[model samples]
Target: MKNNTHHKTIRSFVTIFVIFSSLLLFSAQQTHATPIDPQYIFVRKDGSSCNPSDCSQFWSFNNPDKINQAAIDDVLNKIGTRGNNNNTRKIGIGVLIHYNRHNLNNILASIDKLLPLATENQIPLFIVLDGFQYLNKAPELWNWWDQDQPGYDLKNRSNVEWTCSNGSSCATKTAWRNWASEISLAFPHPNLASPTFIQANKNKLNTMLPKISSWYQSLPQDKKWLLGGISLGLEVNIGGNYYHYSNGINPNAPNPGPGNSQSDQLGYAAIQFLGLEGGITSANLDKVVQNYYTELNKYAYQLGIPRQKIFDHVNSPGFTLPNHIITTPESSLSPYGNPAWSFYNGDAANPQQFDTLHTIFQQQGYIEWGAAEWRAPNTTYSSWYQAFQNNFNFGNTRFINISNWERIRSEPEILKAIKTIANEEPTCWVTKPQINITTDKKSVSFKINPGNNNQKTRLHISSSSEYRENGLLQNIDIVNVPLNPNSTYSKPNLSDGQYYWNIVTTGCTNQRRITAGTFKIASQSLPGDLNGDGSVNIFDYNILVAGFGTKYDIFDYNNLITNYGQ
Candidate 1:
């Protein structure tokens, strides 16, 4: 949906671009934080975490059999006995929605794949459905059909046929709010489960999450289940623009649009083709589904979703519930976007005005998961963009193309880079530049202004001469400044350079430049004044004549600028 404007000043920290890139470069030499179990997040003590490419999903998977047993014992031990370990019971819950019989099997399969994650995390699940009434009731059985707008509320449709045998007639449709109370028993597929028999013609996840939130709250602290929004719910993050995520570089572009809600994200995450009734395939469908799971695991840490509860859902005795399947296109990118949630006045029906999905999902404790497209050049990675919005006052959701676990796998150098730059600190990182010798062949001497207020830090070092345009750099200069705990940045030496060298300092409270190597040098080299190249002879004169009165770029800097005075 379209959004207006809002702002927040989050304590900015080291942009992980360098760290992520480092992971890619040194995948071999770096100490990878392997998956502890399923998708657990690994933090390498701030600066200590040198490798990024090895960052698999969230927690690593360890043979499902072993994982399951461990989870069961852990759950029993924690539940039966108690100690200082207060917040260990959590689980990774996966929830998927289905409409009519179409794509029911795929939904089931998604849930099936979710078990290993659940076991590893140690949590139970509570999957709910808003529009997908038929599939949720049965939990196992499903019917299918081709194209037929079963209408918002499935009432009368061929494939969606219902049965009035077990409960009431097709006329008496049960609402989501009421159905939520009936726990422990799965509803059987009805005769007129189709559109005609449907009564509640409404499907708004925003109107549903709050209602379902109680189910999670009612459980014991340890048994509480976390929420997961599959395709539609997850896709909400991949908003309107495609960004190239590297070193937190803001790729300037036109506003693509605001993100979607959980249900809306799920729809957007889908891939479709308008072939004979939309050329959608199982792979496209699975691709969309997997995006949801992998992303859910990646950002699960931010969701406030308890870790242990998720484990129980996968490893628990009742873990083997029937699954929902998929066999359609609309499941991914929503061939037809849901009218319930959108950027256009937050109303899909209008398609004119817009509001960000964050306005909706952020209302509760739910945070959207940012997933990968498997294929490259994917424009919809949401987590980075969503977080970026907090940094820039642009729109509610700023589009950011950041790396995920998958990128971590592929990029080896990112880890190696971090290793080269980092020294371990158990709690947080202490990244400082290593300037060897400046272009002037002298030590770096610059201004000092620690960015953080009251956060004192040691200050030293000067800016070296700009890189030699004609020759390679000889020695680098780095002044070691012993910074205090919370100091901001130490200043860099200033010069007559026009580029201003972007004024980099040590101990920056904001941009920590953890894995960033090579400091920015002021390129104010005077044409004929080669710093120490002897005399302004043919060598220095040629340098000046080559680059005349140009300001900064005229790296013709040397020890011969006095010739003009002569």
Candidate 2:
């Protein structure tokens, strides 16, 4: 009996030891697993001075001295050595240049002023070409493609008034191609071949590709890496209000036909430029846009800009064609025999938009993708954090350029979010929890997963008032509530207001916290509270009378009468 008891004790001790060893191994793995980090490109709009209030119009080509060195230093100091450990998250700068007649000089001067700073910091510099305004402002350039003759009325040609002066012409296909040709030549590569469109206009255009090529070849070998890439244009799109005037148009115009509006006129112009034999149908317009970008992309590639470095910056994913056909920039440029760069603007409120874009780029076999321009509402730090998180969750996001310099300098929360991303620690949650509010606004629930390892974690929730002030959460309502892997937790009777929540996890050596996002509880609406001031009094009655039949009706009046004081 003694021998059997001793054997049982030994087996139990061995089992517990094995379990403890396994947990220690799991914790070590979780601690070392690196999270995804994306490169951040801060856009210096118009090469302006760094002062948040400084509105100097010192064009880099004309006055490179006005470009503040302090601004560059400030940005670099804030971003810090986070990139030193991970190359993927390296910080870079984007300079927005509005091309003019002296574009070559502008490019050279801008490079001379900025490249040294970039090289010293060992970061990349991107040239963002913004020439749309110049296209309209310069008649000499505009006339080269679409000349406005003495008697020609552009309004008559498109049935809507254009922003161009009475006799000035709107952009034509030739204008776009010529602009592309000029940019290509100004930033030339050795293996470049003139596109067929450029070949057609060879007699009219001049060759600066050789000189540009020489300038690039003359750069010191160490400085060559500073030229990260060039954006062909900023938010390349068919001329909207930029080219056409938008007043005096009927709002209730008929659909599926060209109407007397700026959009309709732009569509009419697009049809002519694309050489399509049809009216301004959505299908026709989609074809026009796709063809324009495809050709523009080809111009850059033909000029020997590496397919990886060339980015087509379209605002939306793509235009929807008839029969629910969807087209993205990736899809349009992929069939031209090479994988094109997939870059877009991140202005969408829906998270699924990012997911859809990421999926499209992957399906199209695009290896490089990013947001060349991303902006968040200036209201809340949560919005900014969510924006960064959304972009970071997608692994292929190579770089994201925060739109303007002023936003960075002015918005403290923007810098905070950027710093948080730079210093993010690995978390134990394999799938992070996201709070979902009930339809009745009475409760909130979330699900979490710690994978097979079942790492230790705690969840917390707090009202927005006590959450995220100066980078710390105060007055947390639910403190360190233990969470189980793959289990759902519900907190009932949540009051009618915004709530913030997060998950805290402890690894073997460090602790990590992650925001699970926010939830809002909106109480049921009171009857007859037209102005939503929590009561139906004389003010509500006054509002009803003021809005009369347009905004409020007899039903509203009756409701107010029934629930007058309460």
Candidate 3:
């Protein structure tokens, strides 16, 4: 009996030991496993506030500068900004809508991205919204009508008729103006809720035109007004006004079309959240921004905003991918006869349009990315370079979506169009102003018409450190002088040896900076004997060692190592 009891006890101990060992192994694996990828952390996000009306969901930014910097830095390099941009210019943006509690968070996000561009462009944005919750939650964001008191009288000071200008059916305009007043009357001050009606959306918009003109009239004459907003606001701001404008989630809301973008519906949901009484989640806000960009080229063009402006938002090289631009040439499939086309999308309507847009996009030095399958809003391409002529035409001009076209294999003979354009830009790149870089340190020489000598010559040279990252040349050395026809750079100081210099030439009267390909300053010639100090010393031996040995540096490395020999 004692032996049997002892055997039972031993068995139970063994079983317990086995279970403990397995648990230990599992825990070890869990602790030592690979870390997860770092996802973007949007400060304003919290899982619970995914809905729009909750202001808590909205990303909080008390300082407008960070938002402004993100925006200005994104656009200035592409769309171009004018003189002396400390980024503190007042820009007016008119959005006509009152975001209910559900969409208020999204409303704030939309304006956040829009404000920097306005500020950078020197335009102050004046938003027209039927108020939900205002003040502290969204700083730098305001609703005139939502404020009550002076909202009505602010518009009348101008000479324009109450709702119509020069007598026309201004039903749309008048209706919105009336709505703003009604929404204002209901929500005179913040509380649990204000009344809801379709008229409120309409009324918030019509309030824009008259009030905007007055605000525009109020600004210092030099300032410009920019209009931004999504959906209902888009309708009133751009659709209703006939104002030449640029914005996202375009083509007016409720686009009843055969090709309804299911993807675009995300924007509607985002708007609904942002337009809510309080606010929406930050993730939702980001999605709204992304969706707007996703529909960009097609919708913007459809809305008649210029292509360059539409492309500007995508100019942020560091903004990550959707962003499928081929960042590294090694990632390119040049080894096979099927290199990915250096463009984005599936709309292949106009082959030339696809081709031209890519050309223009890349010319600005942006790396391009696209979906594996073209997800463009319009156009198509059948094969490489062979475009379907007139297959897609807007009025007289043709437009194509490269996304629909066949991929271009990087071949020796078919030299890609992008490469051709890249090499062709006359060294001087222009965004808002002109800038030229002389990569070579050797002396560069040139005249207005290289072959013709009659033009007055002016050369502006700046040290590399003098140029800002945006390529703006500051503190440059300017030399203005006339030369006889064919007078090679009146000064030959920029030689092959002493070529650590940058030279920019302009026609004295044209005010145009002439672009000479980046040239180098020639290495300063060593005068003395045939070699170092005219002597066959250790210096010469060191020079020989640097050039002949595998350990020697490529250029200056050997020269420096041998310059002063033992």
Using TM-score, give the best candidate's number. Answer: 2
State model 2's lDDT: 0.46
* Per-residue lDDT of model 1, residues 84-111, tens digit only: 1212112222233433322434433433
What's the C-alpha lDDT at position 364 in model 3?
A: 23
Top-lDDT structure, candidate number = 2
Alpha-carbon local distance difference test for all models:
0.26, 0.46, 0.27
TM-score of each: 0.21, 0.49, 0.21
Better of 1 and 3 by lDDT: 3
- The predicted structure with the larger lDDT, 2 or 3, is 2
TM-score sort, best first: 2, 1, 3
- By TM-score, the better pick of 2 and 3 is 2
Q: Answer with 1 or 2, whichever has the higher TM-score.
A: 2
Compose the digit string of candidate 3's lDDT tens values, residues 142-230.
Answer: 12233353333222212111112211221111111121121111211111111222224333333332333343334331232242112
Candidate 3 Cα deviation (angstroms), residue 354: 12
Q: By summed lDDT, which 10 consecutive residues of candidate 3 come out lowest?
A: 36-45
What is the clash count for each candidate, in the order shown?
140, 0, 78
